[model samples]
Target: MRSGYSELLGSMRPTSTNAVVAGEADPSEVIEVSVILRRANPIDVSRRRSVLTREQLTERHGAQDNDVQAVSAFAASNSLSVVKVSQGTRTIRLSGTVGQFANAFDTTIVNLDEQGAVSRALSGPIFIPEALNGVVVAVLGLDTRRVARSHVQLVQSQNVLSSFYATQIRDLYHFPPDLRGDRQTIAILEFGGGYQSADFATYFHQEGLGAQPSVEWVSVDGNMNVPGSVDDTEVALDVEVAGSVAPLADIVVYFAPWSELGWIHAISMAVMESPVLPTVVSVSWGWPETLWGDMAISAIDAALADAVALGITVCISSGDWGSNDGTSGQTTEYPASSPHALACGGTVLQSDGVNILDEVGWPGSGGGISAMFPPPPWQNFGYSGRAVPDVAANAVHYKIHFDGADAVVNGTSAVAPLYAGLIALCAESMLGSHGAGFLNFTIYEDFSAQSTFRDITAGSNGGYSAQPGYDLVTGWGSPNGAALLDVLETLSFAQVQLQLS
Candidate 1:
């Protein structure tokens, strides 16, 4: 208990020393906590061997029904009520008093004096019984109000980036307009945002992308689209960009409750879902890897590994805040830092509105060595640990049709769906129904050799500079439709050769 407390103390960031008591912790104040349990199938082994069927993956990986009983027993032992048990999510919800929870988890309940707002959090180690220790991966809901930032931005300066829309940028980067991502679906994750169908209609019609695109909205963890000024802008941008780039592909917007679990839930749901299996999943959200506890990181990465196995490409925005990633100091962003996912970075494209001029890495593009994960086998850049942003795209001053009008936006957030659309196009044109299975292996080891990516040989993202090949800032640079297709052809041939050998 003492050792665990010491470890937790290190994790907690020190707040203002002045502790003005917002309220006394009533010993009997009821609170709810969610406990995430470990899944049976290990993600590392199952990935890329073969994309598992939905039934195969679920039966082998889903939380066993009996596991819920164990958590119920634990709650009973602690004199707490088992409010809910989710078989698929592998999370058990427990409700108890402040004192009961404090005693049960060996932690203290405290009300934080966070300026004008008051919030609750556990002050000590959240310890589970030895019987449940291995099964319980994480304890959430300790703090009811600490929110992670959404990586969305309205273009702050037109001079810095030269306002460009999705159509112009895609053309400049050599994306074929004819492909239109037919026979593919893109899953866009949104945590706290709502989308209006009228807005989508207006945006698409204005962009000349056509009307009545196939779009589906999914609610996860009881979080749904709540239309707000800030929230609508991000969600709207994602839908608009994906639609403009891949007009024929169906779009699925999975909305979830806020925080780490909300983000993870959306990713896992996208992978495991059937009948609407997306070839590409775009996530325009993330926080510093450290902000997500070890358990949260591990669980999320495990789900992403399954995504790799399922032939569903998950593309996450590296972030818009460069090396520091919008934090107080330099830190690597999550989801992007996860080895199984592709980190999409940002660039400033120079063009004469209709033709390409020059492209440079945006200083706000998030790229750095990850402190959380070791370099994956595919990474061969002499990077000691995982390096972010496998590819780059123009983000600065993107004139996107959002909330019914053309609005200029900037952020790696816009970059994610752009890449997702490309993946969808590649899947339809090259791989057929099988899709591009776990792109990194082919990306780094083989396709990269065929001049698959436009190597950005100049500019920097603060800590790292764009050089000839695979530097931290612009990664292997932006997409070239012809070269990307060439890569697909090359990989397909290599697969045939391997089979024959």
Candidate 2:
């Protein structure tokens, strides 16, 4: 429909420039762009009443001989099975359909006494079962019995250097060892509590890492504030490990109010609007994906896209429960399952004090192909299923001296932030040269090159097992920091050569 001269002018315009002339026909290249529809809201109700209080239930039943017995009785009476009960918070986890449990207890248990509050019997939507081959529905709840016996101990141990591997990898990548003095940033996304300054000061002192890095808190959606002692363990792990790996990098903690929506919103907001826009974002808490709706998923996707666009990397913990997750069948947990983000699974670093024996995928490490998201473009080289744990780090029973706590409470929660800090080191080396947008791409490409990683060929997380090359377990295997850096540097050099050529 346009004349030759008009078409010529349209073709000559710069792709990045936006310009329009009066009475001029728009170029055909500007045809209508297809819009990806936003996902729907997952929450059916905005809010629900709290369930029966621990005190009221105890009063009504006359304190049982032991909390576990009471919990077992409660589960049996409700036709529900108890999976795991946390002794610290008295949180009881029940199995069965969330809706079915909620309906059954809504009148008899949830609404038992007038003074007792009952929280919603929501499903543990994220805990997918791999054993069911992905068919059964499972729900999770807090077991109040375990929570009542609150006792924490702090102990000194040696697995503290595990976080340094990421930094080592980055050093090998580039940034000239002397140039490492440049300032960098690491952002940690947390859902509960604040870190204990005394605890961190003690950790750094014990590790001989010098003064602790500067830490700041950004509250997202009115949930930001200091968390009580009970909830500070996870926060402390995130702060300490992240700081340890990237000692020079400033650490920013973004706190979200407790609740699925609050957590998602906080993460999204940080990804899109944080002042530093951190080189890496580390997340530790996540519910199953089914708990969220399309809207939440879309928001997460958009946030990830924005992070990539801004050259920021996001790392998430797959989950603590193995593939079966004991909740539902074997379904990958959300945020981790999200194709847009890099899911950091867990691994055990076995050593005889002086000599490191081997590293294998942790049986409790969360991984597997996503049931909801298709394989990402960068993940194309691996087996066809939902490949997970694009990467891994030491997670099992690593030793660290907590300032106020005794006992080495081991979980994948520690591994996520440790890796995040390491990634910061790598980003520092690149100095925004790679545009974080392509890190995942770089990982896959490097994996194919076979020079940057130690393929984890053994171990299994429930139904899925690790194999040579890429598998549903450890994606590209554990990072060979020095080798990985070399690959990254090589890729960087290649990019420069391409520009010159």
C-alpha local distance difference test of each model: 0.75, 0.53
Taking all chains together, each candidate's TM-score versus the true structure is: 0.88, 0.65
Q: lDDT, candidate 2, residue 72?
A: 54
> Which lDDT tens digits does candidate 1 get at residues 273-314?
546778899988887766666756776777787687777778
Q: Candidate 2, which segments miss by more than 4 Å at Cα? A: 1-181, 353-355, 381-385, 401-403, 432-438, 448-450
lDDT of 2 by residue, 293-401 (tens): 4434543454455455455567877777778543567767777777656787777666554444787878878777676676666667554544677777666543344
Model 1 compared with the native: what TM-score? 0.88
Task: For each candidate in turn, give its C-alpha RMSD to the true structure in angstroms.
Answer: 3.4, 21.1
